[model samples]
Target: MRKIKLKSISIAIVLIALMLGSCSDEILVEEPRGVFTPDFFTTELGVQGGLTYLYQSTRSIYGFAYFLNLGETGTDEYAAAQSADNNFHDLDLAGQGNLSSTSGFSIGRVWGTSFPAINTASGIIENAEAVNLDNSLIAEAKFFRAFYYFLLVQTYGGVPLDLGGGELKFNNSVVRTSVRNTVPEVYTKAIFPDLEDAVNDLPDNPRLTGTVTKNVARLFLAKAYLTYGWWLENPNSIPTYPEASRTDPDGNSPSYYFQGAYDVAMDGINNPGPYRLLDCFYDVHVATNDRHEEMLFYSDRTEESQIYNEADLGWSGTDGGGPNTAVWMVTPNYTTITVDGVSAVQREAAQSYGRPWTRMAPTINVFTETFAEKDLDSRYDATFVSSYRGNWDKGGDTTPTITAANGMEIAPGDAVISFLDDYDPSVNYVNGGNLGGGEIAGRSDYVINLNEINRRFYPGLWKLGTYRTDNAGGLGSPNGALTRPFPIAKFSELYLVAAEAAVKGASGSMSARDLVNVIRARAGKWCYDNGENEPRVEDNSAAMVAATPAVVDIDFILAERSREYFGEGYRWYDLVRTQKWTEYASSYEIGGNSASDHSPTVTNRTIQPYHYLRPIPRSQIDDMDMSQAEKDAYQNPGYQ
Candidate 1:
């Protein structure tokens, strides 16, 4: 995939404006020397520069591993892996660590990085028209402003609309006192209006490959309306920050918003411009096909240029905030799989096998339940790396051949370890053995039954795994940041969104089941089998559509979303919006964190009502010029 290198520009104004909360008692103020003022955006170059910076800032949140943890670790789709640190454990909501105001899960990335980007967007929006900038260019600014605010509202209930100046104004000066608007105010005043305008103004086709367009705007607008409807419903009685009534400022009912969400999403689906679902699920995520038409928006990365990628292409060690390393968290240490006392499956920077942090693992239900129809639904195969093939020669191991399970000699490129599609009672499990797998009769591969998968040894997320073209037949840059674009939105999700709205009592020509069947039918077609590591052609769309329940509900739609978008960082928000987090993920089963531990243990999480929203970053509170009581009140309900 060719990398689109956006024009680089200095965003000194945004950086300095974000220091508003950092003022001290005895402030030593100085005249700005090298800073660009908001007036700069009135010029043509400055407007273009501001727009470029807005796109650049997305790397801080979307593909960063820590930010992924905030979105997935505590939810049903993932759990803290055996080797996880406090950063992962704190978000787990288990006993490993407390998710306090001081937690280091990088929730503040959404808070800190977003405000500056919002300010930058505001500068462009306020000044672009003065320079005769095209309406489309100004619409980009509006889209970004609404985008950041949507993220802010979802993460922390109601963030400050007024950064330092008035609401949504460009602030060139630093001020310390900040007050958060209510949730209703944020949606009605900022997110809704800006997105609506953007949907109207953005072109049907993108000016640049990855730039926002009218359909992108419509998707976000539909999502915002759907999410706001849920907030108004508040069926779970989850409390909001700043304690406001769960009513729309415009006095619209929840049904009104739900119907609106359905209408907008269907409009996008019907009039899809330059966006459509790929032929199959595998095509959507395969590294070779990164940034395909199905992806509506994504954070771009490239192996072609280190500068454009924003991180070293050769090696990036555990750095967060800008690299596409979130996939590493879900990757297992496949290099540990040995045959005849020789490491068989060597770690390489291939999409099937990459550097493994083992910081997050899939829940057991991911195998037994969510993907129950592994044969009919090709998504299971498309999503995970279930087979570990021998690549000892790639690591300079000249053993030529090694004795594997069943006393069989296996060569390079053969299956060294395979997570079986079905459990076999006849397989002899190696309990307390050095090898963490069982030997199936007549099979040369070390096999792990569906029941034997654990935290330390499970399928790696292949969909977002590393892909590098510079391996040169060796373990190339296994520890480096992934060069594939981390997907943020896809065209397939439009069907899910419209279906979800229909379930929420929206009137639509397509019923809830009809919309869901659209997704399920696509899922049943297979072009490549990830486990077999070969091509396979099959079409079971008929069976897939036939199996759909006549009446689909919210739970069914949530399950479908999980199957489609698992491990891409969509779980927590989906659950939170539907108020199903605690009900669906409060308890899960996984084996102990040891090679010999094969017994599944049920672990429980203390998901509180206040956990619906994360705590405000402690640093943000400390920097504020408010009294102790005021600071406490500014925080979300539970954290203080």
Candidate 2:
């Protein structure tokens, strides 16, 4: 998961870059302009250089902006802080909102970033045969290609399957051969085969955060099978998606997919070594403890050890180690800077939670529905930062207009943001949280109703915004360079996957409730209610069943996933897979403040079934080698 420095890999990229491949079409250079060529890859440095480029692809797929837009914001899990014009917010409008393929934030980035990475991986996989390198490196290349294609399939079903390689084999000729492969074909032909080969080549257990190990491969393979059961049409479940299956090149039975998922999940669950869930859910994140046993794969920020900026990697966001993530997820401006009556000094840009865009706020559903048993759940406190006390000195202001005067003194107990589901209007507004200096007064200002808060000035999730006491919050100003690595995969997901698959078939020694209860036990023990380390529910299978959507089924799994991976970018995909995007969305209203002042929020939001898979980029279809008729055939169910 550690990034391969772009500088170290630029030499190889130059050779590839000389071709100037288009996002929609593979218009590679027929002639070479650099020493880094197909022949160069036969050497050790060339192979390493190519592998480095492959590593760079993880940024866009796992970066902060990409994660926020695709996973959390697209679903009901979060709302972007910006106004309606923000591209990420449009995705949340999937049913009736503007979510077109041409939207730069939605389709273009997903299509644009993935294809190039797939092409890079193809080069390494095809050319590695000419060189004498470790087969593990070649396995790593396949893992990346499979991983990227999976992302594509999940978003845009049946994308053009490109697997060209070598100097002339896959280079210039690929565009002519690239046609939209069927969703099932893409899974069986490209994605699955790659991972199967990769599992054989990679080691059973790898400790490095960046390496492709057998466990992640097993996890992904299981995920693919699960996706196949859900999307490609499962046999056990009714085949409701007529159009998707009619186009299925491989008419594999539903059991073929689900059973495959079940087997791989079991492999991952029974993985050798001490790979277990961490006691505290909060410990799963944070840079210092990044390589914990719970993590299977993560995107590492390389700014501290590497020479580069985010743009060079073709990403929308910068490194996590610096200020990229902090700016997006933290409060843009300090909400509680004074305690009773006191002043803080001029603030440094580094001391900011971030230029509080409030782009992604957890939905009212999170504070209310998800945490109905708030007293029993420790994850609520672990995940959200309710308030901030300006404990650090605001050294100086980088932006003079927003000056930090004297001592920015909010006492430890002072509330910056106290999320309250229950609204008491008398003290709720006008003078919000009466923690006075006349700025953000009364409970109404500092602590707003979950359903009434503005998206931009929303309650913050601590996962994205780090309070770095290291540089007195942070150093200098915010830039694209990252300070923390973004996680892409975690071992905790295996438990959920196992639970879901078991429920789908109800065929294992461990019941669905059995698997879910194990995770709940961990969440309870880590409760922030003082030193309360107790299980909220013992092996209470009967109770767990009653609390489910169908008293033990896919909906139950989806609910658990919401609690586990809320802002981590798995929400949208989960909604789509369960076919519950619209159903679940309809249950929550967009407004909070009683019935009068809730934002249109998600109520105006619509999710037609066709929106399950994103529209194939109009640009991608235009660039394909096929005729209009063939291209039309390639598009997923609901787009022009």
Candidate 3:
């Protein structure tokens, strides 16, 4: 595990510019008393500052911001959590039509933001070498630059491979790279080389300071290779109207970039890197505790990565506030599942699917399908809560009265237990039991029931703000307040990714069942042997069941992904890669309503092939100097 305390690179840059006047008096070669230009910060400190700037951008990687926004919307992740106000609306109403033809909203923002980041990284890399900064720091900057460019290639096709450093000032008239480079070309040309150098130069440990470590480099390298390969080899995952497939309507078959996607991705995975999946059981809780892990390449913190808070539930807070329910419905609840028939309580239970303006609750269909899997392997219980409700095991106040933060005694009136009985009865909201019918404070249209309760997570509401601690001196919850329980990252995913890479790369015959068994072993559970076609479940007590490896397949891995990482924010991507988008859409619905089906994050619902890769931003299209046919082909259908 590595930890790097990053500097505020942007702030440092501004300070340097202010001190260094642009207009230089040629009289004296060495400028005035306190002036410093690109040459001044080009020192070790300056390079370090620059590296930090690249990471600062990572803070924007959540549901509403950037990372998941593009990935979640218009994809299975988007479709999985579609709601009226979340990402689905943007995709449905704004991004409805063709990929090459439409200018969608977020699509444009991503394009604009990505390049600035690329240039920032490029600036650091260029400046570091000019001043001869420490080799390690230079490697860190290079890794960051490569990371951004990789994203650009993946998202916008052949983005201008700007190695221009700080020399090029910001300008809107920037041209798209002469032609889109193939994914393979971009990887070989940029990503692989940088990472190879990075692994050599970066430190072995986190050092509790902000700097790219060997682990981070290794993780990114692995991810880049895994994804590029997966995207390329699979025909369905590849964009249908690939940048290569389109022509000037003159019938010219443009070059495709899939090979690059494959090779570099393969390199990252098989390279003699020290990175490997940290054993999930031992490492999962530890990773969350210190934000330390060999697999996590980046994490975001806006002055603070708040601990889990239990009070907040609905979505009505600051921007980048909590997990957007719209894109997080697929995450499993940690509290309700059992070990050998005894509930394996979630001691560190925080919000998995976050608060919501648009509640992206799992559909009865998703729940049903999940249940069906549980029927096959009771181990799937580790994926979802066995019951949506739990007992209110309050230490002091056993009577059911919840205290407010302001020391106000609030008694929930006539609250109906809003959960299915078999789950848990003590804590659920019941009709007219307390809090006056549990009527959503303002809206009375929807009643208090299992759906709404489950939408909010039945047992307890968690947030980044609330963290529970048994002792006053403890690291588990620095604040000791109840915050959202969002597992921004998890260990189970590493196993799954490894499984995908192994299967696709043909690196090894690591069966999906073997990988799954490893994950279950960590979670203190195991898949049962039902011995039937309909996927039957055999009860295995803490004492009895023997571990037997089953045949691993894509479908099994997918089910595992859905169960384990649902709301942690990668379900939709898994669905798309596995071509389960339409199948999932046909089954799930809006805010837990089965019949009122809608797009996952976007509004209108339709799964078109062109949508696999989002439409290039509408604004970008208008700015492009392409031919009419090219422009027509790229126009945004959903843009208003």
| Candidate with the greatest TM-score versus the true structure | 1
Measured on C-alpha atoms, candidate 2 has an lDDT of: 0.56
Q: Give lDDT for model 1.
A: 0.83
> What's the residue-level lDDT of 348 in candidate 3?
31
By lDDT, the best candidate is: 1
TM-score of each: 0.94, 0.78, 0.62
Q: Model 2 Cα displacement at 354 (Å)? A: 2.8
lDDT of 3 by residue, 172-206 (tens): 22243223344555666677678778877976654
What would the TM-score be for candidate 1 when compared with the true structure? 0.94
lDDT string, candidate 2, 499-584, tens digits: 88787773666667777876776666542331122233323334433444434677767878888876777888887777777777
User: Where does candidate 2 have its weakest 10-residue lDDT segment?
Assistant: 1-10
Better of 1 and 2 by lDDT: 1
lDDT (0 to 1) per candidate: 0.83, 0.56, 0.40
lDDT of 2 at 368: 69
Better of 2 and 3 by lDDT: 2
* Ranking, lDDT, top scorer first: 1, 2, 3
In angstroms, how far off is 437's CA in candidate 2? 13
Residue 115 Cα positional deviation in candidate 3, in Å, after optimal superposition? 1.7
Backbone clashes, each candidate: 0, 41, 83
